[model samples]
Target: MRFKEWDDYIDCLLRQVKFRPDHDDIRAEYEEHLEDLYGELVSCGVPEDEAAKDAVRSMGDPVEAGKLLNSVHNAFLGWLERLLRWAMALLIVLSVIPLLSVALAGGESLIGMAGGYRDTQEHGALVYSVPVGESVALDNHTISFDEVRLYEDGVFELRYRDRLHLFDRAVKWSYDLGFSEVRDGNGNTAKGGSGSGGGSFLSRHQQYFEGFSPDIRKLVIERRGSEYAYKGRDFRIEIDLSGAKEAAGL
Candidate 1:
């Protein structure tokens, strides 16, 4: 139960508190304390009116109390504290957004590795298949050749995976496994190929070439040229196709 005396005392106390922004909070605190004190006094057999008056009196002079509270809750410090809290919140949001993006990209990469391989295999009859499983460390990436598939229609497909090192992953930078130059054992270049790939942190890649020959005993895949080609990194993968030729009955 609220009494007029308690209301009047709190109003007077709040008038002396210079920080208007904190008035509501301070008022609530004082009201809660007075209610508790008033309840305790009434439980001990004091009359309701007397209990209310005693609770207000026990709080001491409102003016002096407000002055002490005003000193403690400096307006400038209150505003600075609020500003720092907001800044910390913003910093947390900024940090988490990139991590979420990397996680999402990593998920998409896994899905692409599974789905894209299945889609490519459906295009032609399987003539020869080999698991290369070779890795080369270049720049900020460890590029691994997972498998190679050649179809009867001269479609050559290479499945590879690449992972960015810790530092590169932290900065959200990615490595591109660009077009590779394919050559036969007799130094004949295989032409006309297209590539597609996607991912972050760790990524899967697929490159397709046309006019591959089953008679070729050796195949050399080389990545070269400017940053636009293979991000300025050079590496060679030499694959012996003798087994592929025998398997395909060439």
Candidate 2:
């Protein structure tokens, strides 16, 4: 027997198998076993042709082996197993998509928050900036005051963020910083400023007011009510502008 003869024997055996998909794997396994047996017989002093013949004989009748393998490799079972493997892979990919989307959205929001002031400052010259880290708790939400900026164009910018308490129940709500009124130390009230705010968990707000007296010593932000359905309690944020005024030589 030769190598060609061994291949012919395997082809004959697989002809009886019903599951066509398992033919390659079964062929490789049978070939490996035959090679090992043939090598052993030749190492024991048997001729190459005789070793191949003995190896094939030791494996038994091809028809009988094929019938046994056909029973084990049922066509239905092989296809079902392949389908299940594919389904499992698809499920894993589907599960990860939403998580990746949420992560990307959150990353973009943080980048915006970090660079928001710099983008706003590009429009005009920055005259003075004062960091006034303050917080006011309303119900389960806490509003934080980050800083105040004055531009040479008479625009007063207030930057803040609103966040929910860590252990608070999840609820859908939004606060508009534009709803708050700005008052100077001289009792002059300035209302209706343009602003923009957005975020997923921690919301960022930027309110821009104009025409402030450069000699102003202090400023106050008073919020009486909200335009949204969830009207929060009244609150006040008093910002000392003395530092800003002095820095700007006022």
Question: How much is 163 displaced in model 2, in angstroms?
Answer: 10
lDDT of 2 by residue, 1-250 (tens): 2487688889999999989999999999999999999999999999999888888889988999999999999999999999999999999999898888757756765765665553365438878888889888877778888888887777777788877564577674665655336777766776436555446556677777766685577888777765873376777778888767677665
* Per-model lDDT: 0.77, 0.78
Q: Least lDDT summed over 10 consecutive residues: which range in candidate 2?
A: 114-123
**Cα RMSD of predicted structure 1:** 4.5
Q: Please give the RMSD to the true structure for each candidate, in Å.
A: 4.5, 6.5
* Model 1: per-residue Cα lDDT over 19-97, one tens digit each: 7889999989998999999999999999999999999999999999988888988989988998999999999999898
What candidate 1 gets wrong by more than 4 Å, as runs, is 84-110, 119-124, 136-143, 153-155, 161-180, 195-205, 210-212, 225-232, 245-250
Lowest summed-lDDT stretch of 10 residues in model 1?
Answer: 169-178
